[model samples]
Target chain A: MTVTKGDVERLIDASIGAAPAPTMDQVKEFVTKTLDYNFAMTLTEPFYIKPNAEILHAAGKKLCTVISYPLGSYTHEAKLAQLKQALADGADECDIAMDVSAFKSGQYDKVKEDLKPCVELMGDKVCKLLYFASLLTEDEQKRAIEMAIDLGFPMLKTNPGFGFSTTVDQVKLAHDFAGDKIGIMVSGGVRTKDDAIAFVEAGVSRIATSAAFQIMADFDK
Target chain B: MNKKELAKYIDQTDLTPGEPYDKITEFCKDAAENGFASVCILPTLVKTAAAALKGTDTKVCTVVSFPLGMDYPEIKEIETKEAIENGAEEIDMVMNVGALKGGDYDIVNDELARVSKACHDKGVLLKLIIETTLLTDEQIVKACELAEANGVDIVKTSTGFKKMLPRSTSVEDVQLIRAHIKPETGLKAAGGIRTTEDALKMIEAGATRIGASSGKDIVDGLAE
Candidate 1:
């Protein structure tokens, strides 16, 4: 049987939980190693952000990065600016932060406006949106999904690792609500393959776990 | 003019927090000189950009609730009014990710329609921010359906930090949206597009609009 990268990605996410990203040097080493792990690195700037091209060629891995970073608090212009920078930094995939505060503060119009520049920046590139707690209410959560659906983003991310991690309920909601539109991804608290599978069964196509490396290395026989 | 030849398709965004008014002025001037599609600024800076781009085709764009997509309908409407009064020609708003997860499609649809109406009342074009990474494929399709049903002009992805979904855009996903969306409807891809090749890939994938901080690079790449 051939081991596909997608299988490995699911396995690793299921096995590992969300932890802080590795240091740049460590990432370089990890990238050099041949593995089935998908790496997404969030950076504050372009400095020290390595592990692309050569690593993908050497190790056969994909790298994920973030634009604007950590918070969806910037204006459309600034968010767009960051999107361009993140792509230029050589990220294969990008996980963008949703404007949680804007949704929470009852600025509905502003919420839609926040994504314009980023949309313009990516222009059909792969991108993930970390909803975080913007959907404090059931209504908000549904609206958030619709937002993702309309934008054509493939993955529905649960957390930004800022507060709560991906929960069973959250994954289920994503799958149950929009299973046909996109893939569901569980991040934050998932630390085991079983945990990742639970999300997978819930219709999650991916899992974001920082412990992916160890999980893949220690897969049970 | 062809969309490619026209600078109106390129916009200069200035949503950086703690940015000085003078910097906004500079951005507006730069956008005008570069023949950008528009100048995206904060609601507060809309007037600054608008005044700077006055008499030029470079319109002013502003956002509401910013990077977040959770807000009451009324709040969004009010914010839309505020942005327009400040001279923003286009409006980009976030959608409530929470509500969609909760299966609250009605609220999502109603809220988006309301915001669209508010923007249309003032003749300003409205683009919805789906925050794509935060959603599922089914949800992504549904959101596109809703946007098309409403009068919303564009469907965009991502807010920079957290994603609507955990992963990034896939070629399959773009094609799926393209297959379904109406011809007049526009698709924007944001988040991790850096090089001209990346932009070209997205364009081939059916996205017409791109959001990025590296506008100059892409434009330069286009020139090259």
Candidate 2:
């Protein structure tokens, strides 16, 4: 079981989000670093989409922007507007945040309604439906996966990482439920190469992390 | 300041992610009864807070683009309009921090102008959150200038989201922005303001409003 740098890079979704805001230089440096690693994609906010689009495309790497972000409290209309604009801003993928409160409150209809238009707008693009899996019940996780599959989202991202920890078991659960019908992206808390390897072995289709460089640096050691 | 007077300067907040509606309604009821300035909440709960605080003096303040503030100006404007329609009296819209930090003042100005117009069109007060913890002193002053130029009614400090770097609002942040803006423009100090003393320091530094989750405790501390 030898893990190489390419193994890590092939499955890694390198991400760099500054605490409050990122300067153009910081964004540029990070994009360059991620591209140097030749990771699968770069997860960024909508603000960086247009500025980083050309470089990301030239490298044949995807640019994913999260709408509604770590907290999915925005209304359906707000989510739709952000999704439309992010795509217009040249994002290759839009990871739509789930309305966790509505889903947690048993307002399944409201959650579905909130995501329907976003999924429709994303159409054939890589739309990853993100859920704060660390906070949900098993039934809730299942429902989220099923809904994403039904809504035609190609990927399911577990958690948005701003303190939310995505367990290997959660990735396995999503993999078991979706099979090959939906790709599973494990986000948040995968800070080490070993953590990434465990998730990849657990059937995770991709890994999104702010610690991509650290994980790659630790690959041999 | 006494409890009653201090209460008028506080925006009782509960932006905890995934908080239930019932809890928000209860929190709003409590804040309204306590006579806090407003109850800052997520956009989804603005309607609930509005209903709970109806017939009370406390206004409903909701966030747009929230902690990140990186959304396009158009989306921020849409969020402002929707929150206002849902009964938000005051909007704490996150300024496009990335634009401001990237030296893209045009993008920052466009966002401020758009959200300001949306909020002002509905006669809703707009507080532009600069996330002071992330900026340099110079950037903070520039942010105040851009916020004022766009007709922002208030300049807020942070989203209090507990970021990777883990910074908080300081009295100097409030004072710096206060000194830069016109006297008529309001200043709000949020993020890590938990104690009565913390609230007073912000007010002393020229903060006209305080956004805190511990509004009740601060007010009660003054009461006792």
Highest DockQ: which candidate?
A: 2
Q: Which number leads on TM-score?
A: 2
lDDT of 2 by residue, A13-53 (tens): 88885444777677777887777777878877877788787
Q: Please give the range of 10 consecutive residues that has the lowest summed lDDT in model 2 chain B.
A: B159-168
Candidate 1 lDDT by residue in tens digits, A193-219? 566556666766666665565545545
Candidate 2: misplaced stretches above 4 Å?
A1-3
* Candidates 1 onward: DockQ, in order: 0.02, 0.64
For model 1, residues B29-107, the per-residue Cα lDDT tens digits are 8877777777776665676678888988777887775655544455566667767877888888876665565577776
**DockQ class, candidate 1:** incorrect
Which number leads on lDDT?
2
Worst 10-residue lDDT window for candidate 1 chain B reads B1-10
